[model samples]
Target: MNRRNFLLSTAALALSGCTTASLLKKSTEDTIDYQREKVSGFFASVDGKKLVVLGADYHYVMDQIGDLPQVLQSPLKPRLNAEFSYFDLDHDNHVSGQVTLQLKGKVSDAERQKLQMEGFECKGFQEEVWTKVYKVRGTRYLAKGFELPASVSKFNHDYEIIVRESHSPGVKRAMVLLTPVTLAMDGVLVLGGIVLAPVALIVLSNTHWR
Candidate 1:
């Protein structure tokens, strides 16, 4: 190989190395940001008679419960939290589960009924749940597509979060799944940039230029 060809290959490898360095830095920053967000956020839950919460353990004991986020609002006081439950409202149990309701535009009676038949319940715009939804001009209704669970005299416990890990369950699971792939990517970057690229340059210069 000529000097020109060797120089071109070296330039290409250097560019590749720079790109991979940027990728590695970005990947690391993203992972750290995600970690910070997960740890900073809070979770609220009601086990049975008391509100079983990580941060807010001082709320009044209640004989009967009110709406979840409402009951939690004052006590939680400035910190944001999402309520989690083990009761399968939709009867579809997922490892990562939540009942998500979103507002739709101008839902007529017929449309409301159709959504209802499809296991969605429509709430009027006046409801607290629909407050954000009502901001949109045409969005008149909020739909939650799930069959409400049987009224519990006492809450049933179907799941538990062991306090061994600081990371959220979802994040922990994701990291476990992504670890191998992340390691493989790092290995490739290190090999191509640090080891293989230099070795290739030296070998080519010694043999081809002679």
Candidate 2:
């Protein structure tokens, strides 16, 4: 090949490789953004009886991410050492229970008024299960109780407790709309990884690139 032509061909190949690499990097970043926004947090039940939740744990299926951030603080922090109980309310094979919540934090008078204006009344009582959602001193607390029907209790059926919150002063509200259901831990792990994988990859890639 002539010197001029050879140099031109080599330059073209380099340009092509650079374009491909740029496109790949862009694609990866886009995937990461989608996964980040798709993070939907949930509380999963473990052992079909009690819920072991690190509140605000997010999961995604595309990138395998989990436990993004609890973000429980800032006017509403999670109450540590929370406990729940279940009891049989009726003798007719039905169960019921009550939930009590204790929270510690600070709330402004305006926010307190806003919370009341928002009509944040907690309601989730059935069989022997009860859930009380409330805010006190800028801390949010969800106390849940579960009781199984006599027939179901025999087999120790699993249960999940979902909590929802709302505020009038434009605070981000948290809610659990789906009916409590059983989910495999393996599925949860996989979904969590999908959500967090992009962030992890970006961090690692940037480190290596630098």
Candidate 3:
């Protein structure tokens, strides 16, 4: 390929290679791992932080009704829900590893305990109001909230940062497990395979092999 065409091909191939990794990330965050379903909208750039969403989905029961599907439904299905995720703490995961904090704000003691039982650690210091705020926005199944990548100190600007959620009998935690470095490395591999391989061939073609 000519120089311009070759360069364009390289970028396209690199991005397309990222698609598979992105899909894998999506499946890991989904309750059902459906190829088309993704909860990534809940995630903002977070200044390109090194973080990851852990596990496939959330498993919990909010109350008696929440337990009914998993316990008494005709065709049995586990009571699983997708978590709403966001990056937390100024301290980087790359430097500090995973650390736990008391989840701030109005989340009830029982609800917090339930999440702790499920292995979710408290992430950030911000008020935990997304669930209540989301209920005010609009109703949807399997909801998620994404805070803006940047921080703002103003009260009126709250909407610009955290996403709101709807009301429901059940409570859920935003969980994560991977580092942003992992995804970055995946991109590097794709760049090496799809982009650099062809460039190396081009260079080799121009110079005689000794």
Which prediction has the highest TM-score against the true structure?
Answer: 2
TM-score list, all predictions: 0.21, 0.24, 0.17
TM-score of model 2 vs. true structure = 0.24
Which residue pairs clash within candidate 1?
Answer: none
Error of model 1, residue 124, in angstroms: 9.5
lDDT of each: 0.26, 0.28, 0.26
User: Local error of candidate 2 at 114, Å?
Assistant: 44
Instruction: List, residue by residue over 153-205, the lDDT tens digit for candidate 2.
Output: 12122223232221223333454222232233433322212321111000111
What would the per-residue lDDT of candidate 1 be over residues 21-42, giving only the tens digit for each residue?
9998776555421110011112
Lowest-lDDT window of 10 residues in candidate 2? 197-206
TM-score: model 1 vs. ground truth? 0.21
Q: Give all candidate RMSDs, comma-separated.
A: 25.4, 21.3, 26.1
Candidate 3 off by > 4 Å: 32-210
